[model samples]
Target chain A: MENMHLDQHISKQFNTDLEKLRTAVLEMGGLVEGQLADAVKAIETGSMRLAEKVQETEDEVNQYEVNIDAQCTEVLARRQPAASDLRLVLIVSKAIRDLERVGDESSKIARMAIELSDEETDPDGFVELRHMSSNVQKMLNAALDAFARFDVPAALKVMREDKHVDREYKSAIREMVTMMMEDPRSISRVLNVIWSLRALERIGDHARNIAEHVIYLVRGTDVRHISIKEIEKQLDQDQ
Target chain B: MENMHLDQHISKQFNTDLEKLRTAVLEMGGLVEGQLADAVKAIETGSMRLAEKVQETEDEVNQYEVNIDAQCTEVLARRQPAASDLRLVLIVSKAIRDLERVGDESSKIARMAIELSDEETDPDGFVELRHMSSNVQKMLNAALDAFARFDVPAALKVMREDKHVDREYKSAIREMVTMMMEDPRSISRVLNVIWSLRALERIGDHARNIAEHVIYLVRGTDVRHISIKEIEKQLDQDQ
Candidate 1:
């Protein structure tokens, strides 16, 4: 009877620890999302202050990555979870690395924001960029939701949206280069915007990586660089 | 007697698995190293055919990465290794991913080689480009050796090499843009070499990443994006 009581206590402790790990990771994800939003705002409104804020936030993301990695190690050592549970902790650990990378790219965008603010590109020229930003922002939120709910289909959709982000980025690059060629006065400003667009596109890629991990955890398959249309066919076959 | 027999079997089986993992990784490393060599050769000699070969080799590298990942997963499930054994498997898995990325970038170079072949720019004008290609190739080889022997000092040297690669890349970019501005006829070819330089620089970065991961596995520390001077200092401090 005493041994059974101790077993129950240990199980409860592990559950608490797992919850702590999940909360810690989700918190990190939230901060990255916030940085992305702030970076976009910085670019749109030409706010050096907001850009600085996004840069500062990356340090926190780095700390979170370190802390989460250490915690996952401890849990693996102590809990020795098998199959799904083990994959879950490992996935979270890897996903947080991607999240931290997202923070880094977002911070790069913030730097570009400051540079562009100094040069004064017209806000009108940033409409396509702003639209791309919103799309990536929405994708990030949906990805986080997919993680929170363990919703594989939603996560898959978020992954699919990354292609749109890439397409928008290519168009942005072409447009900005043309702008630079046509008016050398705006060259520096347009270049900074192009850098920011590249950063945002990368942030979207990392967010998509997180979504991929989420789906991997829930579905136990690798969805890396695979098309969503094919994935849909996969789901149908699975069911 | 039974316990002794079991211990012997476990040790023998563990030793064999470790040997297998090491051999597999080394083999994959060999293929990737060859691919990188071809990429540099293609660009340096301006051989579109060599570049095409590198691009074709990427499919083989991808197959190796997939094979190694599967083997690692199977080993993890079957052996459930701990301590150094666990670390070894995990490190190799991560290494394969890094190598595959290296292959991807080399393929990018291959594409650039084809583009440059069609470019009208005088191939004789790119002295700095030739030097940078050799530097990147040397770094890849050194980094591969660093991985093979877990040589921290060698890896530190490889990290220092990356700064030179970046500096050369920027110089090449400046030179190319100047050539383009001086003669619009130079745009297409100059841009192709610039893109190739960018890819080569990134390849150097990925090599540095592998070297850092080697340190991480050997020493359990993350030295990403940290200065080479500091990394060298840490290695000295450790010794």
Candidate 2:
């Protein structure tokens, strides 16, 4: 009965700590999603104020990362969770880093948006940019939702959607390069678009990484450095 | 005496495990440094053989990351270290990821080198690329050496040198853009150069990240998401 009582106490403490970590991560996820959305909207509408707002939120996001990191370290040191619980802590820590990076990437796009708002508008590629931005935002939202629910299928879908983001980025780059080659005077403006597009592409990568962490947590396997086809096969086998 | 013996045993085991982890990280670091060297040489000499060699070493680098991650997880689970020891483990894990990514970036440069080798070599940009590559390699070496010795000054120096890499990258991009604008016929080749330059820039960023991890390990302060100026001020106060 003494052993049973000790196990009960340990289990209760671990669950409470895990819950706290989850809440903190989700709160961070929500803030990052907001920053990403506002940054994209700023670019779409050329709103300097909105862009500045996104930049201002970066400090808050950074604070979340530090706090979440501390919480994870505390949970690890104090709780000593093992197996799936341990994996949860590890993946939560990893996901927080990716989320923080998404925030950073959004800040980059916001800075570019602010700079581009002052220049003459070029609507030629803005439509594609909006499309790509919305697509990436969707992936991030899905990945965060999957994390909140621990839904592996949702995470897999997020991973698969990243390829679409890549395709869009390539086509956009091709278009931007062609524009720059056609009009030398617009080189600097087009270069800003190129940099902003790269930021969006990197944000997509961070979202994919979050989704990968979710899969790793649930499947107890490392799917990184492997082909998506291989990952799909493994998922199928697990199913 | 019984309590003292238990404490000694735990301390010995933790020290042994940490030493093992450090050796694994250093081994991974050495392989990554080799890959970076070969990748740069391939670009400089336009040698497909050297590029392929870098590609071959990628698997070995990936294995090291996997092995080191397992070791860290085991140490956390079995020993449950706290305080600075815990921070060391966490920072070591983070550093290993950065080192692995540096390997990935080198592979990217290698693939670009192989593709560019088939085309007529442009010696004009090759000189700049060589300079940037060597500078980045030096930064990586310094960062790894700092990690090995836990030397804060060397890490700070590595962080400072990243600005030089950035200047080199920007100048290279400006030259490439000018070349593309002057001769639209060379757009494809110039695009390749742009991609290669971006990869090198990313490598410098990874080196900076490693230096930041070293700072976190030594000073127990998170230096990321802040300006180097702020970090310098904080370091001065600490001293």
Give the C-alpha miss distance for residue A197 in model 1, angstroms: 2.2
| C-alpha lDDT of residue B87 in model 1 | 62
lDDT of each prediction vs. the true structure? 0.75, 0.83
Which DockQ-derived CAPRI band holds candidate 2? medium
State the lDDT at A16 in candidate 2. 79
- Candidate with the greatest DockQ versus the true structure: 2
Q: Which ranges in model 1 have alpha carbons more than 4 Å from their true place?
A: A1-10, A120-125, A184-188, B1-10, B44-46, B123-125, B184-189, B225-237
List TM-score per model, in order. 0.87, 0.91
The CAPRI category of model 1 is acceptable
With candidate 2 superimposed using the best TM-score fit, by how many Å does residue B35's alpha carbon deviate from the native? 1.7
Model 2's DockQ score: 0.52
Q: How close is candidate 1 to the true structure, as a TM-score?
A: 0.87
For all the predictions, what are the DockQ values?
Answer: 0.26, 0.52
